[model samples]
Every structure is written in structure tokens, then in C-alpha cells.
Target: MTLAAPTPTVPLNGDFWHTPLYTRTVDDGPAVNDALHALVLDRTRTAPTSTVGVRNADKTSSDLLRWEHPAIDHLRGWITDAAWALNDHVGAGRTPSGQDAEMIAEAWAVVYRPDGIHQLHSHHDAAWSGVYYVSTGHMQEGTGLLQFVDPRPSAAAREPDRTPLYTIRPEPGLLVAFPAWLRHWVTPYQGDAERVVVAFNVGFSRS
Candidate 1:
């Protein structure tokens, strides 16, 4: 029998932001969520006392833990694959002539936000950043919407002809990827339930 031709792998940058909202309903998502909850809660108990600004509200985050847990390595792998796929789409001209792409993972948590919400900001040193929703209650309905602002100031200032901002509502198993420099924020949750999400940043290194 004649062998079939192999399907070629598509480049990542071709469709990087085509799907800004990437979601996966893995069977392991619930388990991962449970683990994240426990991790965040445990850390919160002994977390260093510090205050952080959440939009107009004041909130606190667990100390930034780089590779503190074993699970983080797994999460890093998942993020790596996803980031590679995204980079294939957005990485073409962004990288130098002969440098290999590099990606890094940084994880953090935000806790105790009765009416707290993060202000519009971008990851300065990262190439891409994402948030994975862990738990959101009914009262916190629509609490985890990630809003991305247009980068073009001139286009934004064009009055009625301005480009519309994009908003993405993430489910428990959902993951989103966007340019690290894109301004974004989370809306305040109205309900009493606390919203928890694991956020990460990925970037390329000069190889």
C-alpha cells in the first residue's frame, strides 16, 4: 500500500490571537481546581502581610511563589504547550533572526476581595499572560470576565469610529492568551463569594 502524505504542522504566529479565549474541559480540571483552592488557602493562612491595589479597592495576594509546588511544574508544561501554539502564530517577526523562542512561567494568587477588582494593566516583562479561574459563586456571576483594551491610542481616540474593546468570560476550565503588553482587568464581584484564579506569564529567551 502506498504511504499517505504527512500533514504539515502549521506555524504558531499565523493564528495566535485568532482565538483569544482558549478553553479546555479536561477531566482533570476539577481535580486541578481543588488542588489550586487548597494551595491558595494554605498559603493565605501564613502569607506575608502586605497590601495591594485592586483597581480602586485594596486587596492582598499570596506571596509570589516561583516553583514552590510540584503541581506548578505540570501547570507550566500545559502552559508551555499552549504558549508554543500561540507563539507559532505571533512569533514570526517578533523574534530575532536566529534566536530560539523562550517561555517562562510565573504563578500568583489574589485573595479576600469583597468588592475588589484589579485595574487595567499589562505584564511588562512577559510576552504572554493568562488566568485560570478556580472558583466563582453565583453571587460572583460574571466576575471573571477578562477585558482587553485596544493598543492603538489613535484608533481608540477616534470617537464613534473607535475600535471596540474585547471582553472574555472564562469558565472553570477556560484559559486565555494575549500579548503581555495588552491592558486588561477584572471587574469586581458583587457576590460574597471570593473569586480565585491562577495567573501566569510566559516569554521568550534569547537562545
Candidate 2:
């Protein structure tokens, strides 16, 4: 008796338990950069912090979220817009009445001089986090890339294309947002110009 090979006819279905990352480029680029120079640049000169990071020489401003700086003030509209976008994304898998609550928790500026870097870390005690590139002068490879590592436990077993980490080259007037718990870092800058960014965290709150 000859046995015939079985044919598999059912279509395979798949779902990705994926992470969401958001990016936006400000339309009014010149206005945004002007504000950064007018407000943020001078403050970093005197208030550089010797705080948490790979480099002690890196100039990171104290939490500017609570401050009354004009630049910070100008970010309110953008921050609110970002929060709403996140809320919509988080609420996508839930019932309309069960949507997530989100708000900007805090913000600060980071200035990485040549050879400066921010070590790998995650934003704790928050629901979302983001960065706005105020000035990323002279875009070039290895000039401080913002990177995120895969949070999946299966990362070790994935293929090369599924490599665990990915990076974004900083550009002026760009904004990027992601989950707060995701691990991220900045590569050591090699350019002569400072890589300036405004980083912020978002918290969930009752409406």
C-alpha cells in the first residue's frame, strides 16, 4: 500500500505582541529652533548637573518641567498633543470607557558634548516617555544615536534582522515617544557640536 503525503490547507494567522513608538517633525522648524536658542541654550551654560549618566562632564539641566522657562512654556501644546496621541494608542485595545490616562510627568534638557554619552536606562514610575531634539547640529554617523533595546524575552533567539536593539539619529525639531519601561541609551557623540535634547516622562492620572 502506497501512503499519500498529507496536504495542509488551513491558512496560518498571526498576531504581533509588538511595541509602539511615535515620531513627529514639527512643521514650524525655524520657530522651534529659534526658541531653543533664545531660551534653552544659555541656561545649560551655568546649570550643568553632575548627575546620573555615563559621563560626568555631560551637561544635563535640572528638571525644567517645573520651571517657568519660555521654552518649557512653549512646549505645553506639543506635550498635550503627544499625550493625547499616546492615550489614543493605549486606548485602542480597550473599550472607549476604559481608555488610559496620561499626562506629562516631568521634563529636562540634556547637552552631550563631544564624546559624551548617556548610559542604558529606563524611565521608571511613569507610563510614557519622550524626547524632543532641540538642536542636533551636523548629522553624521556615530554622533550620538538614541537607541532602544528589545523588551521581548525571545530577543536572544531571534534572527539577525530581529536584532535586539535599534537606534535613531537625532535631527533638529524632531520628537519621539515610547513606553516608559523600555530600555534606551545614547551613543557617545563624536561631532564637534553639542547634541541637545529635551527628555520628558509621562504619568497616568485620573481625569
Candidate 3:
């Protein structure tokens, strides 16, 4: 048989090491908002004397409702969805079973009044963390925006044109979830109406 020449091939270039974020909206948003608004402002629920940054200015309940609260239950389901979405996005084909079940360690409500801000911090001792906006209030530019800092130190140097930070303006009934280790903060609120949010932390457990 006659010999034949091999054709040349080219290599493909693409992005790598991208972070995953999961966002969702509740189906019964209006009902959930009503329930959360009332629960966050419930006078009987004790607001702890928190020493965390700017927490004194914002209203917060120390109560971690694992069950019994309808809003919390709804949020629990949504967060679980976020976890599974993460499993699909990051672990697809990498592992046989993907991710395991997640355990809700704590859940609480936060109300940000004018000038309220949560200092830059990361959730410790949890695998996943998320926040649900019960009421975003009248949000304007730079008013109580949720911002996440890039966890990769080399990202900024690698992509100088791209900003190393990401921001999300909270909307009613909106939920945002991410890895617990990512550092994030809320910019000081400038609106007259109070901004309400429910936050939770989740960890994985073996069956």
C-alpha cells in the first residue's frame, strides 16, 4: 500500500478554574415574603448583643430555626437545590456520586436599616452558605449591595481588565448561594426602607 501524510491538528484554548454561583427565586414569592417580613420583625424573637461588624446597627435574631418556621423550611429546600446545582456544575463526571446531603447548621434573619453594613467576612465551619432576600427595599446604586471578593489571589494579576469583585443587588424572594469560604459583605444601605434578608449555613454529613 502507498504511504499517506498525516494532517496537522490545532490545540483549543479556553478558561479554567472558574467559580460557581447558584441563584434561584421562590415560586410563591409573595407568600414567602409576607411570612419572612413578619418573622424578622417579631418582637418576641430576641436580637442578640452581637459584636460582629455593624451588626449593632442592623436588626438580627439569634434564633437558628431548624424547623417549625414555614419560611425557614422553604429556604432550606431552596438551599438544598443550590447545593445539588453546585454538585452538578463543579463535580460533573469528576466523582461517581457527586455531592452528599447537606445539614443545616443555623438559620437566621437580618434587617438592614439605613447605614447598616455587614463587614467583609466568611462563614466558618460550614460547607455552604446563602442569603435569601425577603425584602430588598428601594435599592439604589451602591445601597446595601451584596458583594463577593475573588478567592483566587492570582485571578487579579492574570486578568487585569476584569474586576476581582462581583456584586448582586438583592431583590425580593431572591436567593444567592456559594461556597462558605468565599469572603463577602454588604455595602452600607442608603434607602429609607429597611432591607430584610434571611441567611443560613449548611454542612455535609454522611448517611
Candidate 4:
């Protein structure tokens, strides 16, 4: 028998796809950031040139998250909660039992002076990555932007408003996190005052 005519339908809206991005403006973040800025800048006094990745910026150790300080301690708790929240998001609100497994982490505090920049890179070793902006510095627009390259290679060019690269103009207390494998970079810091952030990654403990 011939099938009946198919029913006509239209989507609720023109937008068809979505990507998950996690963000939060922290409570009491200003005070926490002030303490961290001083702590990290002071740490750099002994080693102002050392850096990691392709970053043209000064940074405290990649192990900065491991160090003990009141601000770091507060962030440690926040990061744990944030990572778990990300787990819930990825799981569609049905998080698996093992998803809450202990996390092994690496984090650092970066201070970008004028002309400082970080080239595109991804954390090949971690399952999640994040950044918490402490200071954006005295700068005009288009400076020190955090840009994430589009992950879908097969997609066609998008509208100008939907450029291939996703970017964020950082502000104090803003925290952002995403999959560790997503490639991203920072635009140059044109501001004379220092631009600061605490960047990090986390993966489940293997052992």
C-alpha cells in the first residue's frame, strides 16, 4: 500500500545547532583576584622570564594551583565545583557515577604586560581546560581577546557575527571553561597595566 502523505513541519526557530560554554561571575571574586594578583606578581619577581606553551607572557609555575595560599584555596574549591558542573552539562544532566572521579590538575597564573600574547595551543594531556580572568588592564577594544578556533572543520563559513573563531572580551571575575582539546589563544595585551589570569586544566586521576 502507498504511504500517506508526510506531515509538514517547521522548526521552532531558525537556529539549528548549539555549543556548550560554561561561565560564571564569581562571588567575592574581586577580593580573591586582588590577593592572587599580588601573590603571583610577587612570585614572578624571582623569575620574570620563565614561561610555557607559546606564550609571550610571564607566569608563575604551572604548578601554581598546587601552592598554598588563601586565594588559591578558594579557587581550588571553585574549580572542583565548576568541573563537576561541566560534567553535568556534558552528560545532559544525567552524570555517570565515575564522572565525579578525583581530578588530577595543573594550573598557573599568567601576567601579560604590554605586547604580551599567547599562540594557539591545546592541552593534549587533560580532559578539561579553563581560564579565570583577574584583570583586563587599561586597554581599548580588540586587545587581549581570548579566541577559540572552531572545532568543526567540515562546517562552511558562517555569518560575520558567527565567525569561525569564538572570542571573549575578558572582564574581572569572569571564568570560562571548555574541553581541553579545543585550540585557543590570546590576542596581544596592548595595555600598559598588566593583564592577569589564572589558567588551568583537569583530568580524572588515572590511578
Leading candidate by lDDT: 4
TM-score of 4: 0.82
Residue 51, model 1: lDDT of 45
State the lDDT at 150 in candidate 3.
83
Candidate 4 local lDDT, 132-182, one digit each (tens): 998888766898999988777656554445668877889989888777888
All models: lDDT? Answer: 0.58, 0.66, 0.67, 0.73
**Backbone atom clashes (below 3 Å) for every candidate:** 8, 0, 0, 0
Q: Model 1 — TM-score against the truth? A: 0.74
lDDT of 2 by residue, 31-129 (tens): 766776556667766665654776722445546666665666556555555655655555531335764333436777777777778899998877778
| Candidate 4 Cα lDDT to native | 0.73
Can you rank all candidates by lDDT, best first? 4, 3, 2, 1
lDDT of 1 by residue, 62-181 (tens): 234353666554455555655665655544314456544444456676653566678778887777777766665443556646787766666645575754567766566555666677
Model 2, C-alpha of 129: deviation from truth (Å): 0.5
Alpha-carbon runs more than 4 Å astray in model 4? 1-18, 47-49, 54-56, 92-99, 157-162
- Per-residue lDDT value at 8 in model 3: 25
